[model samples]
Structure formats: structure tokens, C-alpha cells
Target: MARIKPQALLQQSKKKKGPARISVSTIILFSLIVVLAVFFLHSTYRYWSQRSRIQIEDKESVFKGDDSFLDSKKSDLPGYAVLETAKGSITVELFKDSSPEVVDQFLDLCQRGHFNGMLFRHVIKHYVIQAGDSDKLGAAEDWTSKGKNYNRLYTSLKHEAFMLGTSKTKHDNGAFEIFITTAPIPDLNEKLTVFGKIVKGEDIVQEIEEVDTDEHYRPKSSIAIRRVTLKQSI
Candidate 1:
């Protein structure tokens, strides 16, 4: 049997250790690359997600009727209407310049007594007080298919909010249904046709909002709208 030299044995040992060291370094390098790649992908996804969310929010903000626009002289005239409820009367100033079509349709309904004796069909605290559900509030069955009824009014007005710009918010023309927000909801600015805002009797609106409601948000006790009369500014 040939005996291996000490120097040769040391060389063989070095060769074996060299491959192990290279394998360890290669594995460490590969692991570092994988970690970096995962981190980059996660960061990129987050950036895009945040950018998309910001874009959607920015688009929504545009339709909130820019504060500068509201301050401008081009804003609507101070025409108002009284919504006489069983609780009290709420005066809402119509936005003729901002939402002319909505105001016109509402006034037309008022002239035709479409909202006379309508119930405050739905109420949600810190949300909205909905009315003009003529279908549910005992409107004449014949009026269902008749001229300028609630259903007809819904289809008449183009969702004016979207006319301002594209939006992700759900578009609701709200042609016949009049809803008063209990709070300043910017999201609703372009989603719903905001024909008017309550100028007076906000307390009455608050009272209506506080009314006891059922699971479906309908007032347990009937809150009737006695009449809706449009008052022009002299």
C-alpha cells in the first residue's frame, strides 16, 4: 500500500474544503438575491397600490365642487325651498348654477305636488334622511306609470356628478328621492346629484335623523312630509 505524504494529504483536504466553502458562499449569495427580489416586489406592489388609492381619492376630491369654485361668483343664486315636515320646516337652498337640471326636476315635482304628504321613508343617523319614495308612500298606483312620477324622475336627470369627471363612486341621479346628509360626506359629492343643501331648519333635519328607526332604517313612527314648496329669491 502506498502511504500518502503529509503535504499531499493537506492538499486533498484543502481541495475538499474549497468546494464546501464555495458551496456555502454560493448559497448565501443566492439567498441574499432571493430576499432582495422579494423585498423589491413587495415594495413595488405597495407603491402601485398606494398610487392607485391616491388617484382614486384625488379624482373623488375633484367633484366635491372645488372650494375655489364654490367661492367664485359663478356659484348658484340663493334660491331656497321649504320642506314642511310633520316635525318642522327645513329650508334648502337650491344649487341652480351647480345643478340646474336637478333643481328644475325637483321644482317641477313640487309644482305637480309630487312630494305632497310623502313619508320620510328612510333615515340613518349621521348619514342621510331619504324621502320621495312615492312608490312606497301610498302614491296613486296609476301615477306609477304617469308623467314625471318618482320612477320617471329617476331616469330623467343624467348623473350630473359624473359630468364633472370620471369617478369610482357609485353614480345616483337621485332624481325624485331627496336625501339630506347629516354630515359632510365628500364621497357623495359626485355620486349623488346635490341639487341643494339645507340652509335653515337643520335642527329639524337633525330631529328627523334622530327619530327611532327599524332595522331597515325606516322610522318606526311615521314622519310625514306635509308639503314641499319652492320659494324664489326676490
Candidate 2:
């Protein structure tokens, strides 16, 4: 190889290009765009979350009514229902405003005498006492077919002791089977509709709870609802 000259090497070095450098303004602009995109996504998510929560709260407010606890005063109640059973009388305060559809259905059934003489088929000690089994009375087909399905009514009412609720399967626009809680049933709070609460028949409910039950949680002796009378609120 021939010897290269210093002046020629210097000229070749000067002709070679170096890596290009990015300006600080371009980098800052890119970073700002990324930050704005993340902030926009976060804000959108928060807006939708708050909107969904507000919708649920609004829906529940319709059934929240005035009472929130179990010990509601009789004078503040919307109506009253007296269940004359074989054991004793159970006076229940109807949540007419909170559960208008359910209360109306119950009142209609009482007026039509559909719950009269209905036997208490399901009973459990320190749990619940359930009655109005249309199947046992040979009227399941008639009862199930007469009403439109009400789906589920989400209410603020809880399944406190002496709370009267209808069967989970029969939430329709007609008569529904009834049950009274002997204890606080939290698992059934939103699952069942609470139409009324026992105001004057705690002892009677306790008496019914004490009745002997068989292996199927059914009362050994026949317990019947002789009549149900409705009274308007004063």
C-alpha cells in the first residue's frame, strides 16, 4: 500500500458525517403528548365509573323509602297487615311506599282471600318460617301463570328479624309466597323483596319458630294462616 499524506487524511476525516442530535424542544413535545394521552384515558375512566355508581344509587333510591332500620315506628308506616294464623296474630307494617308493587300485590291477595288457610310448609328453628306454598295447595300452575315476572327489585331494606319477604321464585305481578325471618339474614337482603315487617307479633313469630320441624325443615304440626286483614295507615 502507498503511504497516505497527512493533509489527505485530514480532508477525508472532515468529509465523514457524525450522528445527528435531537433538539430538547422535540423531546419535550413528545413527552407532553404521552402525558396528555395518559391523563385523558384516566379522566375518561373516572367519568364512566362515577356515572355508573350514580345510576345504581338513583335506581336504589326509588325503593329506599323513609325507613332504614328494622325498628320502624308504626305511626310512620304506610299501612298495616294483620295475619291471623293458627298459632296467633302477626301484625306487620307494610312498606307500601318502598315496595309499592309488592305491597299492592299482597293487599290484593288479602282482599281476594287467597292467603287464607294457607299452610306454613317451610319452617326452621332460629331461621325462618315460610308459608303460602301454592304448590302444596295444588294451585302452582294457576298462581305461576297469572302474573308477569317482576325480575328482582333492589331495595334498601334488609332481611332483619321479623321482616316479611316473598319467595325468590315468585316475584311477579300477583300473589307471592311469604316468609318471616326469625333472625338477621344478610345473604337474602337483595335477593328477596321485603314488603312488610312484623311490628306486634314478635312473640308469635318466636312461637312459630319454636315449632318442631322434620328433616325437610317443615313443621310437624299443621300451621295455617286463617285470615289476613289490611288496615290503612292513619
Deviation of model 1 at 148, angstroms:
36
Clashes of 1: 0
Once fitted onto the true fold, the runs of candidate 1 whose alpha carbons sit more than 4 angstroms away are: 1-78, 134-175
Expressed as tens digits, the lDDT of each residue in 1-234 for candidate 2 is 999999999999888968778999999999999999999999999999999999999878755754443335434433999999877999998887688778777877888899989988877666677787553422222222222332234333474678988865653545478878776654555456778889997999899879887766667899899998877652
lDDT of 1 by residue, 31-51 (tens): 999999999999999999999
Q: lDDT per model, in order?
A: 0.64, 0.74
| lDDT score for candidate 2 against the true structure | 0.74
RMSD of 1: 18.9
* Ten residues in sequence with the least summed lDDT for candidate 2: 138-147
For candidate 1, the per-residue lDDT at 69 reads: 76
* C-alpha TM-score for every candidate: 0.50, 0.55
Name the 10 consecutive residues with the lowest summed lDDT in model 1.
159-168
Every model's Cα RMSD, please?
A: 18.9, 15.7
